[model samples]
Target: MFVILVYDTAVERNPKVLKTCRKYLHWTQRSHFQGELSTAQYRALMAALDGVIDPEHDSIVAYTTRSPDLVESTTLGLPLGGPGEIL
Candidate 1:
């Protein structure tokens, strides 16, 4: 499976988030990453990052798929709730 995460710059931007994600994903491009992982690995990675996000101005968008459809199917969503609710 593959995971794609998108972030907005105005709210918050952290290099650490990208650094951490690198352990699980291949840094495919700027502000975008992808990797092949099992369901369990993906879940664990997401769970590990639950507290590492800055929702006040930043966002983490995670999507999983068995095919390479991120470029064709990904859509951005408004950050809802508070920064703590970004998980």
Candidate 2:
């Protein structure tokens, strides 16, 4: 699956969240990441994040599709960290 993961974490837990996300996806910008993963990988990524985040304090959203081509995005300004889109 192609996944775009965005997270907002408490200051004290921020580094762990970032580190976990990076292990599974490309860091596209601050608090944002995108990449491809197998179904197992996707589950693992979420599971890993769940361990680091406090649901009461952190926010994580993931957009996913069967293939990268099924998604599209436009960048209004300079791309940050790299492109934010799957393509």
Candidate 3:
């Protein structure tokens, strides 16, 4: 499946978070990332993130699909359920 993990944190701390994400995903843009993985990889990514993220400030939204639904869903005015919406 394909996954788009959207995240937000302090500009200074973003690099660390991004680095961790990059270890598991492909960087598509400055703040956006995409990747294809099995359920195990997805769970591993989430587990790593849970230990590293600070919920008081930082937020991570991991959306998964079999295709590029992230961009399509946004353009189609779909509701993204997470900490915040991208559109």
Best by lDDT: 2
Clashing pairs in 3: none
Please give the TM-score that candidate 3 achieves against the real structure: 0.70
* Residue 69 shift from truth in candidate 3, angstroms: 8.5
Model 2 Cα lDDT, one tens digit per residue, 1-87: 999999988988988988898898988888888999999999999999999999998999999999999999776676856654431
For candidate 2, the per-residue lDDT at 41 reads 98
**What are the per-model numbers of colliding residue pairs?**
2, 0, 0
lDDT per residue for candidate 3 within 1-87, as digits (tens), equals 899888877676677777788888976555667788888998998898887778888888988887655456343343333334222
Clashing pairs in 1: 11-57, 12-57
Worst 10 residues of 1 by lDDT: 78-87
RMSD of 3: 7.1
**TM-score of each predicted structure versus truth:** 0.63, 0.89, 0.70
List the global CA lDDT of all models.
0.64, 0.88, 0.74
Among all candidates shown, the one with the greatest TM-score: 2
Preferred candidate (lDDT higher): 1 or 2: 2
Who is ahead in lDDT, 2 or 3? 2
